[model samples]
Target: MIRRTTAAKGLALAAVLSLGLAACSSDGGEAGGGETTDTNGNEETSAEPLTIGTILPVTGTLAFLGPPEIAGVGLAVEHINEAGGVLGNEVSVEWGDSGDTTDYSVANSTATDLINKGVSAVIGAASSGVSLAVVDTFAEAGVMQISPANTATDLSGYGPFFARTAPPDTVQGAALGSLILDGGHCRVGFLVQNEAYGTGLRDNVQQAVEAGGCEVVYGGTGGGQEFAPGETNFGAQVTDLLAQEPDAISIIAFEETVAIVNELVAQGWDFNGTTYFCDGNLSNYGDDFDPGTLEGVQGTLPGAQADEAFREELNTWYTENEGGELADYSYAAESYDATILAALAAVRGGATDGQTIADNIRAVSGSEGGTEVSTFEEGVAALEAGEEIRYVGQSGIGPLNEDNDPSSAFIGIYTYGADNTYTYERQIEGSI
Candidate 1:
């Protein structure tokens, strides 16, 4: 679901079979919307408008993530406005680019700018590193910050004002471990980045594998690149992976995926026999590599694979409004849910400040005995009608536990195909 703006390997691609196979399948619950009015019965605004700002990457290494995430925000805004904007004030969005983690200044300045503008809540900074850089700023400013794609386990204890719709890497890693075992793979080796996201995930995956009486082939070998062009060589890392002689290798990286995959193939390693990837590099590789190079390759992404109908609808909307089709929808559902939760929190609290929304967020996302709703209009109406509302939207958000993370989630398992593209294979349902 992602594309990097880099050059491809020059080797002749394997002849593709069944190129563009059957459209991928997905999973998620659905609901309908109806008329809605604020609890105050006042459809008009008497207070300062509620402004939600986004720090998603519009021009960075993760810029490919921008379109779907940004579009998700836009769609939520449209839906919320149609349902009656939060607190009777028409909701509006302030846009800012989180140029990636290459520079903290860009993220810091942008976070400061959004805080200075008195944003009630913030939506992104897709990279966990980018979010970490500016999270404290948003927290100090008392603004609710939610990330759609950050999965680092370290972010679990972020302050009360911080939460994310996406589950942590711990959940994903453990699920992926179970997946490997279920697939008859026991000797899984991880060639992961040496950082919070990678280490956290690696630890979880190791724990799960070891718990299942399995062993990690190379449990501690760091495979991260220096994140620099020309210097971001993965030959040594690939050599290390081969040295471990792991039955399966799971790669965790960003733009460096191109080189790592190339190295694996160039060295005569079986490209699809035992290679795996995580969210950061689990993207459509139809252009980056040979046509059928990734056929039979597998990976895990953090959220549910959205259903085809919704995907088509989203792609259509994006083309009509945002200039192109949504190539990647990995975090789109989470982005939409995050925005909706923040707005619902504001509406429920009847205030527009961060702390108030923070206090009420969990309440609107009811944990027990609440009416299940999927849209803002339905949730708002349910709240007004004095019925407990539980919002299970596009991504199927589970209970936001006390740690501000999901108590349960659906980790999508995907498999690459003849065209170097992937389709959903199944889902691993997990919980605390």
Candidate 2:
């Protein structure tokens, strides 16, 4: 495989020195120990260690999602190691934080640190906009990047080494649009976050709604009804959105959703039963709002609901390792699936490099016909027996498409209760 490297700007001098020291300490083999055949048919030995890193949100607007995502990665690592590790060596992980778009420096620095640490692949940046900021860096360094929750439609086919476990907004948007129309809402409005994720989903939802014979009364793409990412005060935007007299309104944002809801209540708008939320803001609002403040509100989140067994496993692993109770299982399944897929790809390709993982990820995901397996141990065993194995992980996603997006996925519908918490109503499957 061809190797690529570029100078990472803005990194601290200590980090560069650390990289140099690590290089000096190398045992003269590939970062992960593996044997490669030369052009002359001679076998050469190299180190084969698969180091995975993470750029998940630990702080910022999306921090609420951090616990489950982090737990998912940790659980997957534990499983892979228990399955005798990857490439004959224990798999190691380096964790870093990917703050929201409000601060690109956090993700930028984290990406640099992970790359410098010689990670073969990264799982990361739940926010699509945050992923967009650092994807090029990972690509330039030949590191595979797989996001568990980035759903922006344009991110499909964005990079040869970039992939996501989450279905794009096309699936979630259609499901949400249908939900609104089915609720007898004829005039829909959107208060979007004015970013790749928000706008892309808004457009897809609008298309679905219009096709269903419902009119978008406000906040259509390019209508200038969007707000900045970190904008806290929503009085004017809420006033304008309410002025349109929309019966159904979707607030597509992150932490700012709390402020927007408060503004809506202050303006005498009945938020109950009329508000909608997307994955970016479908979190439990019990701590932020009064009881019954969000009663009857509905929202949509991508991915199939995790079953009880998997949830228990994740919670058990998290409490033991991270010392916390798992509050939500939003993208935990997706994150675990992403890690498992990468490990299976490494086993199939006989190496743990990013290019090898990228080349084999689709095949491991069942893009082509193979023996179906569901766990890391099963997949590794099948591959070792000279069988092509398809790894169907906890996330029940179909094979990877030509663009590296899931061919089909399930979108979960949820409704808020009187305590400002949401309960899963049902799941709708959509094919890209």
Candidate 3:
């Protein structure tokens, strides 16, 4: 669910949301320990020590999302180790900071470092831009990589070794369009950033809305900014929206949705009794945007209260291990899944080496060996059985399609309740 805010006049924010949102290849035989012999005629163990690499933006703009993602990785690691390190050998992680920069040289250097250190696979670069920059390097090295939260459609076709937890923005946008129509909105406008993420999301929404029998009246565009964080000076865009007089205006931008909402309210622009927001603007964005301002907005996401059990568990874990707050972000869960998925792939491949693990990543995400498994434990068991394992994770239940893209369930629909609090509305009907 998302919050609704008033816009000034022009409702022109349907382009910026796509900005932030990977790759690799290898084919040779699997490397590392093959087989071993033991006394007493016991079967030899193929257990070999392995290390995995992780790159997260622990500082700068996206730092807030890093901690939870890292925590998820840690939890997955603990679970894997407790069950006996993959293949009977200890597994370890090597972490690096992406440092949040436009030039991904830092991220690329970090990936090279991990490759040199001999990690079996890599698990991050939370931001899609960073992931794209370093993906080729990892691919060249034959190291498999899986990002927890990148939704851009372009990345899916980048390489064989790439996979992600977030469904592409095209699917998400389409889902949101259907949501807007089902919610009784006839005319939908959009506010977006002028980046890949935003354009991608806007395109999806446009297509979905058209398919859903809704009309697109206005679409706004803006450049990404760090200062606003969830607020935007969308006066120009709001003015345009007012002119279009759309029934609902979907802000497909980031960090500016709230500002657009608040400005509209201040200007006395009613939603004209329509709702606003898309997945890009679904976050709470902290205290910067008043909760009361979003009393009636809505959005489509990959999770929702339907998974209340997991939500409660996540909250409990944060309270116990963190400072009592789940970092205000959604990507954390996906990041954790990536780490776990990579680890499981390493185990199935039977070697910690990059080529071997990269070749076998499909075992965890593909259909041949992966079926009827949705939890981390289930994936591990399937791997142990020497059968291809289908790992349907906490993120969703869909299997990874041939493009290395997992079909995702749009289960998160939210609404703003009284007192600036948020509540889960209802889950969406199907997978994207």
Candidate 4:
């Protein structure tokens, strides 16, 4: 009645040992004693607590995304450590900043420092530019990195080391294009941020629309000057965009999309003209903005909340552990799933070295041995049995291609009612 697999037992034992010590400890001063071999083929002892790093943009344009992403990662880590630490070592987490500037250089520096500190994996860089800056660093170091939110198309091919739980915005952009076509709009204007996230999404959507024989009326860049989340008063840009009077408009900034909506409302722009927002704008909808602002708006999202299967547990877990805050936005669930997938990969990889972990990531996310691993226990068993394992997680079934992009669960549709409630509309299963 109380049997445990070797990996599980190792993790449990490690957790006990870790709990006996401090919940947080740095390198060279931790509790456990089992040594794992490094890439150099030399035997190295596992630290008393295994450490992972999270790079979050806690105070910038993308700041709104950072907390939920961190919360998800933290929850996954907590769940893992509570069940059993990895390989019988308590899991510890370290923090680094992505800064508020949306600068990849800042993300790069922080990621580099984390690498030097010897973390097995990293769990963030929600901004696409930041992720791009550090992808090569993590890849070369053989460190496994899982992104919760970076949806830029450039990242799919960044490296073997870079993988994300969220489907890239290209998929969402294309779906939005289709949604526009379905809603009987032919020409539209776009006001996009000039960052990797905004540009990539806008480009994809524009390409999709062009391919569908539609025309782009006008496109301008925003978010390049004075980029800040929770900022409103886009009167200048709205005046310019309204001058074009296109059939519709796409707002592609992260949180600044709200500014665009507010600007439209202030000028009494036609909200009934099918203004479609991307996933980036999902979390920012609230009563702070006018209720009529997003009444007829449609949102294009990658993967939706599994509300029926996951909401109750999600709400309970978040409230108990995270002060009643739950991630109900894009990539929030995916981020949680990514953390679990990484931990499971570590267990299946049989060693904690970053290269081994990276290799194990593919095994779990790709189709090489999918049937063998469907749950945490199954993955551990497969590792013990020495069988290759593939972990298909709850973040909408992953089987990546050579580019490390998910094949299942393409872009989907969501509609925002005047009550500021988002409803999942439909799922698009093919490439746009």
Candidate 5:
């Protein structure tokens, strides 16, 4: 009985998908669908399944999100195949684990393998650092790369081939700062990992916090304290931030968040209550921490709360197929949407080639003038009828903004309950 709501509906910013049978593209035949030429003068494409590669964290700090994120792409594939597949064929996935940013070895190798395999797109690299590590590879190869959970503002200029369903941390950071000030916290301190994700978000939060007429006791001007990628010792970082005696604190870390939160408690700080978490560490620390330790803690993440029925369905699918409940739902909806949007763009552009998908991708995600559809089947049907579509996915994400990001999307404010986990408190909508 988890509580859920698409609360962004009341506050959504601008945003704006398609489907159909074999359609015409500049290419005589789409590589993913109908017929393609072989050097052997044969029209047979390889019997190997055409795949979408996923680079989710499976062995790293973000592994807690692996199950749900993996399941998300799985379910999207399920839905695509049911709609007669993308381009007259069933869709498949190439899965790879992104072992966080401390070492790019795993992500680099996995990305290379997926790229070499000719996947039309790569669907992850959830951490901003992880994504940046090889985003240039995809861009150089002209491949479409979509992220389900990347929010660092720096990624805005990563390139056209890179798109994300998750709004940038600029948006989430601002909202978080505004939320803090609105709550009357006049002095704030931030503890962040020293990485693209942490630093970028911290900078944005600092901007918003300062703009809201508050003082930032830590970070940049207050002497920003940064931790290494895999650094687990938080006692020093905690001491650094608390030395400022700030009224509120912000913790930006991955698995390391657990250690830091616990340490703050040991130091008798209202670390959980007056503290805030961004997407990087906004997860179910419920089972790992003592009951109610993280209760009343607040955080913000892109996208509105997903519909409960869809949540149940995704969980049911995972339970039956992968066993056990979907552990975390943080970026699951965005992951599903990223895969589906890529697939639909392929269909609409009438090819499974990366370049084609890239060119027509924005057509399915902008602010206005398209038929609105939710599921793959519905989008396909509309395209068959020769109608354009704008898909708002499970998380209530809107159309892509001018910069090829979810310009208009929701930033859900979440609060940990007595279970030491979180539920959506509300969704704020605006463009960043």
Candidate 6:
């Protein structure tokens, strides 16, 4: 069975009955409930309200991703509340900043504050390295940590309390590797970040590319050629990589991509379909480069492209609530799905605690056969009708597997135009 435990359902019923009795007798309108075990095996009240905290990149290297991700979470919260919330109480969210890996202080302190605030789950730290820094803190506190955009392979099965809506690097890596090979590039060079996310993804891409009869001429995994996170200057790295005279080069870093691109251009490297990008470094370079600077370059990002209706909704919601327009939609769908899945798990397990969510998330994600649902309200209605519901949300990810990663997902391929902005070319589906 996908559900790890059967005890939560009975406990949830008991808590509901207890609350009912308390509501009938109490003058202050406070409800009573039974205690349950958290992920850390500590006793906690089952009647606690569900409060999710976000540790997303509000500042630092990945700041460009903040707007859409935050909007996705906010929209999910709005939809959940409109559906009468989980366990008969409205869901609440706390926001915090998860700066990039360059400064662990931001993520650590944010994780500390969110945990101290009694958040049942945390949905953030988009960068895998940032998550690696704070995941243990949340895990030890019995708080579920679900990332919307973490793809490092090492994070799979990191802990029972750790889950992510994003598929692992295995899926994206294979897609990107196949794309590069299909371009007829047999010699590839990498400019990977020397961190968990970068190295892990680089390894997967290397394997896929090599399997397709290609050679990594430079900067493959463990070649001691990766640049440090937050590296400002890449002249040396770019020069060394280009010295190999490879037919193709892949840049696997975050904000440092701008510097790398500048160095590549300065060294007379062509971006005309020869350069590839992964999710981390793929962004609108219109502001950073002149027209046609990145023309024909291609990149891959995980998650299905948001449809026009969803994009408009996200834009409207963000503009109204956040006073900003949604720019990048990279992990927005994944973020929305992550939030909804966590909420449904809470409902299914009948508790607003992390352990219960961990126990039931997979089942709600359709690891076991169930009625398909697309919205929070539909899912709630199905669960209320005594049916197990499989939530197929905006991201279009497959069911959560035993490793807590999506079993299958879509990888979006994009190509840059003359304006240095990327357009979705197509999607490749992969199973992990």
Q: What TM-score number comes out for model 3?
A: 0.78
C-alpha positional error of residue 411 in candidate 2 after TM-score superposition, expressed in Å: 0.5
lDDT against the true structure, each candidate? 0.74, 0.84, 0.62, 0.66, 0.76, 0.84
- Count of clashes, each model: 0, 7, 49, 8, 10, 0
Quickly count the clashes in candidate 1. Answer: 0
Candidate 1 — worst ten consecutive residues by lDDT sum?
20-29
Model 2 TM-score? 0.90
Q: What is the lDDT of residue 10 in candidate 3?
A: 31
Greater-TM-score candidate between 3 and 6:
6
Q: Estimate candidate 3's alpha-carbon lDDT, on a 0 to 1 scale.
A: 0.62
Q: What's the alpha carbon RMSD for model 2? A: 6.4
Runs in model 4 deviating more than 4 A are: 1-30, 33-49, 100-109, 137-142, 220-233
Write the residue-wise lDDT of candidate 6 on 146-211 in tens digits. Answer: 999999999999999999999999999999999999999999999998999999999999999999
CA RMSD per model (angstroms): 8.2, 6.4, 9.3, 8.0, 10.0, 10.3
Superposed by TM-score, candidate 5 places the C-alpha of residue 284 at a distance from the truth, in angstroms, of 1.8
Score every model by TM-score: 0.86, 0.90, 0.78, 0.82, 0.87, 0.90
Candidate with maximal TM-score: 2
In Å, residue 135's CA in model 3 sits off its true spot by: 1.7
Tens-place lDDT per residue, model 1, 1-432, is: 111121223312331111111111111112222233344454532345677888887654566677788778777877887776775656777766676666668688779888887788999978888888889889889999988888988888688988888999878988878777777777877766655666777788878888899887774534343234222677776776688778777777766677878888888788665777778777777888878888888889888888887677667656755556777787888898899999988776666678867987777776654888888999888888877677888887687888888777889989899898888888877775
Task: Summarize candidate 4's per-residue lDDT along 1-432 as a digit string, tens digits.
Answer: 011112213223443342221112222323654765432233554533456787766545666566566556665666666666677776666666675334456677777888887887888777787777777888787777888777898887677687777777767777888888888888777877666787888888888788889877766333243233345667876777678778888877776776677678778877664688876776546686767667778877776455554555555554654344554645656777777777766665556667666676666765575454545656655665556666765566567666666765656677777776677877766542
Candidate 2's residue-wise lDDT over 18-77, tens digit each? Answer: 222111111112334656432122245353788888888866788778778877887898
